[model samples]
Target: MSIRPATSLSMAQPTMEGAGVHLHRAFGFHEPRRFDPFLLFDDFRNDDPAAYANGFPWHPHRGIETITYVLSGEVSHSDSLGNTGTLGAGDVQWMTAGSGIMHQEMPKGNAQGQMHGFQLWANLPASLKMTEPRYQDVSSGDIPTVVDDDGTSVRVIIGDFWGKTGPVDGIAAEPLYLDVSVPAGLRKRLKVDTYRNTFAYVFAGAGRFTDASAPRGVLLEKEVAGQELNIRDLSGNQTLVQFGSGDEIEVQAGPDGIRFLLVAGAPIEEPVAWHGPIVMNTPAELQQAFDDLRNNRFVKSAH
Candidate 1:
């Protein structure tokens, strides 16, 4: 029953991606080793149609899983396998680009031209890197949301929490993805697997994730209650809060409350050979993937 201490904390960066879509990049395309079994996380939020209308054109992915969760607006997607669908508010699509797949996502803003969503990339292990591609699309209605008596709530997206399992499964990472919300001035603790590498991304509201030593965690020192802390709120966003080896995390929400995603997974610990969007175990395997793509034989027949 030991509580883990906060090892390091840093905020995400404000970067532009996907044909001029302005968003915050939590981590990606640089030093991917810090977080094993996880590759990239993009916070694509916009309030203008012109900022996200162009969207992400067709792109290829292999040896990985891309999870897209939509908070508001809609994202219509199409893939090379002839699968197409529209993800509305609160929906999530987990696409496993095992062998290989080409897909496109175009975001259509709502009545106010406001769109918000998140996409997280998780790497597939060498064994399942070339498996057949598949999709797990979970609608908002199907996702279970549990509210506690203290006004704290959690929407289980993957793995298990609050005695509920997320709809997305069969993943190699065996990860736990949770959307947690704690009411103003409330303290909450969640249990995590001791062997898993866990971190939390605060996207809405504000909160302090602290250990027994640093009970106050961090304070932006200036923002009013309920407003989104900007990048300058270094004490708030961008800081990656890494925890020690423990099985539970304690967090206390600010006056305005807090909402964030808590994710954890067992480290692969194998060599990572990544280029562009493809991740393999070795350089030779990476070259082979490119060769297969050039020869038009990226996908193996489902047996």
Candidate 2:
């Protein structure tokens, strides 16, 4: 079993979105090809109600899919297609804005005004870009969570993990999205498809990932996982770890344990022309999407 080293690693940058809602952007709106078949990943975590209550007003999205996973609090959403719902804590909503759809999301914090969640955007292939729009609203109870013998729990959100399949389906990327949490000081080896592009995002706690060739014990914080190890090493939060060509990954949880999202997908390899929520293979196609939106002919009838 070969282990691949991590490539691009960076701390989540502070960015505000959705009408002044404060959040952290892990990666997005730049060089979409580096993470092909994937577009944006935003970590919307805040303890202040005023920072998130305004929420995202009505916005148009086309040629892509948006996955909203609520770690805490609730989000009430409605779309132009008349679909509406509320995502409570641990709930997940996968919306395929195939052609186009105007949507609005309003987040409500808990009694203490703590709101935390994540939203990831994935791109659709050219063939399916103009398909009918659809929604997959999976409640927390509907998702499959598996616990290992070592007390590591994995919640399958959008793809296959640990012999279980997520409730959301019909994705163009054929990606595997997993929320994993490990107990303190436990070393775990997880298998992944060798052909897919893989990356892990540390959301809570810190851990050590083996396979990088940058020398051992030279712990890296805020960027790579190795630079200088210390007792005060809580630097993995919001850090992205991209792996090289490997079929399995090894991770050793820190004393405080570790929790993260491991995502992988088969690259589309096609050219990407992105403009906001719209993505196309060529500039002409990108312009066509805008034209369709301006003419009110984006969403097509499925029947």
Candidate 3:
């Protein structure tokens, strides 16, 4: 099994969004082609209520899908289609803004005034960009979690993993989204499709992503058997690791263990004319989307 090397590593940048809601953006609004078929990812984890209470007011989205996974607290959301719901801890909401849709998300902290969750934006192919909008709200209980003999656990969210299938389906990208936790000091190798662009976001604890040919650096771990081997720096909370092509990824958990999100998807390989929440193939199409919003015809079908 080929081990995917770490192509790049970066820390999530602190940013403000949605009426001053403090969050960290792992990747977005820059280098669009680097992460094809995926637009943006935000870690909206906050412990201060005032920092997130204002929440995201009404916003328009088109030609894309938004996936929100809540780890703590609750998120109350509503859309222009007259759909409303509250996503509690461990809940997930996958919303496809095919034609167009206006929605609002308000976050409510838990009893401890702590709110933790992630939002991922996936780009839709040109063929399905104008399809009907839909929503798949999966509760925490419905998501499957698989455990290995070594106490490693994986929560399969959007694709088949460890012989279990995720609850959400019919996505154009057919991506694999997993929440993985490894026990302390355990080295684990996880399989990934070589055809897909893969990335891992470390959110809890620390770990080292082993790449045999990685460049030498102060972060490098000890050489094995006195042979020249390169290991990536220990990745801790809010770190993003982009992997090179391979069928598997190997990592060593630190003392406190590690918890991270491993996400991969096929590349769209098409021109991306994007502005704000709307994405299209060309500038003319992007302009037309805004014109539709002005003409009060953004929502093609409301169900």
Clashes of each: 7, 6, 0
Per-residue alpha-carbon lDDT of candidate 3 for residues 264-291, written as tens digits (9 for 90 to 100): 9999999999999999888998999999
Q: How do all models score by TM-score?
A: 0.92, 0.93, 0.94
lDDT for predicted candidate 1 compared with the true structure: 0.84
Q: List model 2 lDDT by residue over 180-223, tens digit each.
A: 99898888888889988888889888777776575242122434
Best by TM-score: 3
Per-residue lDDT tens digits for candidate 1, residues 91-152, read 99999999998889999998999999999999998899988999999999989898989988
Worst 10 residues of 3 by lDDT: 215-224
Given candidate 1, what's the lDDT at residue 52? 90
| Full candidate order by lDDT, most accurate first | 3, 1, 2
Range of the 10 consecutive residues with the lowest summed lDDT in candidate 1 = 230-239
Output the number of the lDDT-best candidate.
Answer: 3
Q: Which stretches of candidate 2 lie over 4 Å from their true place?
A: 212-234
